[model samples]
Every structure is written in C-alpha cells, then in structure tokens.
Target: MSQPLSVPESHPRPALIVVMGVSGSGKSTVGAALAKAISRPFIDGDDLHPKSNVEKMSRGQPLTDEDRFPWLAIIRSTAERVCAEQAHSGEVKEGDRPAAVVVCSSLKKIYRDILRGQHAASTKMPAEEDTSEKHPSGAHLPASPALQTYFVFLDGTENLLMDRMSARKGHFMKASMLKSQLATLERPGEGEDGVARIDIDATPEEVEGAVRKAVKDMVGM
Candidate 1:
C-alpha cells in the first residue's frame, strides 16, 4: 500500500471550508492554496450560481437576498457532495474523511448561517422553501450528511480590494461592484464558531501563507 503523506497538522476531515469575501479578495487563489496545503479538492462557488445570477453580476448589478438563497443552497449541497466523494475515493482509508474547500462571497450573516446548514429568518429564504431535500415524488428525504463547516473570511481595505479587482481580466464580477459588496459584507462575529478571519492586505504569496497557517491553526490539528 502507498504511504500516507504527512502534513504539519491533521484536521478531523469532512470539513467544508468556505473561503469567503467580496469581489477581488482572492477567494479563488486562497481557496486553491488551502486545498493544496491540505491535499484536498477545491470547488469555486461561482460555478454553482444559477445562470441568471451570473448574468446579473456581469451586468454590474448586485444580487438581492432573493437571488442568493438558491445559490447558497447549491453551495450547501455541493459541500456535502464533495465530502462524500472524497470519503469514498481510492486514497481514503476506512474511518477517515477528507476536507473540501470552496470559494463563496457569503456576504451576510444569514448567508453564512445557511451555508452552515442552519435555517435563517424565513424572509431571507425563498418563499415556502427550506433547505431540506425532497424525492422525485416530493417526499421529504433525510437531511444531508453532517460535516463541519468553516469560513475563512478574507478581510481587506476597500482600496486594496478595488485595485485587485481592477487588475483582473474577463472575470464575471466587475470592479465597479466592489463598493456595494463591501457595503453588503457582514464580518464574522466573536461568537461565531469554526471561523478564521484572514486579513488580505498583503501580497498573494504572503496572504496564501497566512491562509494555510490560519486554517491549520483553526482546525487545531
């Protein structure tokens, strides 16, 4: 049998890490780096958004709460799917799980709560729809598999973020929307669990190094 690779720490695995921030905060870069550091798979939350949401964002319009719940639901489902897939992968041994990382803006507390598999105020969710899954016959199925969800909130100054956004080429999100995104962001609270607030006011290599270390420490592994 092949030997297991060694890292500085060992996380419990089955952890869904949401690398979150507004536009140009380097969610994708940092998320990918963290996944590499952990030897896990990474998914970009932007790819989970519905086509309508993509079009809206491309037009430089900010999404309303109505436009976000469906997207967040997709993220939540994908998180569980990623962990399940990794758990059954060839390299994973019995009784061991793997972590999954994804990039998401998750600008509001309600959004973050939804990602954590917690129900938020009804007004925030789509009308008459909850996070539960249903069968083809509309029967209520069991809830999703339990996985530890964590957030790596990338915090930075508006000017710094704006500069990064402007330098990007052909990204769906526009630099003009950065102001609104900053306005929409809700920083993690002191009481929030499993969160790592990362400051991104540094170079990519520097920020990525911080992200890797922060995740390692936050996992306490």
Candidate 2:
C-alpha cells in the first residue's frame, strides 16, 4: 500500500529513518536496533534487490545505475507500505505517523534522491506522480507531507571497513567491491537535507544509543 502522501498541516511528519553506507558498515545492525527502540519496523534494503542484482553481487560484480533504479523503487514503496499499514492500524497517534527504519547503500546522490522522492533523469516513476488522481476532485490535496525521510550515514575509512567486510561470512557483496562502492559514494553533501553521520569508533551498544538519539533529535520520534 502507498502511504497517504499527506497529513494534517499541524502534524509533525512521520520519520523515514534510512541507515545508509557501503557494505560492512553495520547498517543493518544499527538500523534494527534503532527500529526496535522506536517501536517501528526494520527493513533490510538488500532484501529488496532484484534476483539478478543479487546474483551479480554474488559473482563479485558491481551494479550499474540501470540495475539499481528499480530496486530502489521497491525499497521506497515497501517502506511506504509499512508506514501506511502502521497508520491504518491506528496504533500511532492521529498525526504522529509511525516511522520505518531501513538499511540501504544509497551510494550515489541520485540513488539517495530516489529514496527521498526526488526525480532525476530517467528516474521518474510513481514518486513524481500526483496523489490527486486517487481522491475525488483532489479533495485530499496538499494538507502536508509526512513520512519525511532522514539518512544516517555510517562513516568509516576504507581500510577499516574493508577489514571488517573480509572477516564477514555469507554476505553476497564481496570485500573486493568495497572500493567500488566507496568510489561511487558521494557522502551526503553539506547542502543535503536530513543527513547525519556516525562515529564508527564507538562500541556496538554506544552506536545504537547514538543512532536512537540522532533519530529522535532529527524527527522527534
């Protein structure tokens, strides 16, 4: 299900917490912990990747833009579906739409833009469509925009992250491709909206605590 797309103007937006980084940066680790802390659902973005993409990664190949766009769309829709279901269940406050924390690489600016509901060349899809078509006479128009997405970047040096990836087991993304991802990564720019970075030197418990505090501070969850 698609998110409502709009909420009351007076209401604070529902948070879409995206934990992003290249492989082996503890994205799923911290995202799951944060989702539990906030009583929201957690989604592993790799699970949303297409079979072909997964296969390519397993073969130690990198995904190109053409390969990533559709997968990114799935991630956005799945997260929205979770948010819509949470809102429909009435478990959350009227306007305090519940959040969904997701782990994604979101390597490029365009990739992150897709998650943010922004359009780029050839990236146009449902995110650019109007919700008015779903309602009579556009009555449900423009009250507000909820499910605002915020990105938490897991920052670490290539050497450190590479060492961690090499020691991991059973993941499709090979350690050899870490440099490819790091090269592609455009670390959320200074002008980027709702972007924050992590302190990788901290312990696991400390990292989770820091993520929770950052999400709350950023989205008031």
Please give the range of 10 consecutive residues that has the lowest summed lDDT in model 2. 135-144
Quote each prediction's TM-score.
Answer: 0.77, 0.80
State which candidate has the highest lDDT: 2
Residue 25 alpha-carbon offset, candidate 1, angstroms: 1.0
Per-candidate Cα lDDT values, in order, are: 0.71, 0.72
Q: Which ten residues in a row have the lowest lDDT in candidate 1?
A: 134-143
lDDT of 2: 0.72
The residue-by-residue lDDT of candidate 1 on 16-116, one tens digit each, is 78999988888887888888888778888877666667779889787877788767766766666656556555444555556678899888998888788
Best by the TM-score measure: 2
RMSD of each: 7.2, 5.8
Clashing pairs in 2: none
So what's the TM-score on candidate 2?
0.80
Model 1's lDDT to the true fold? 0.71
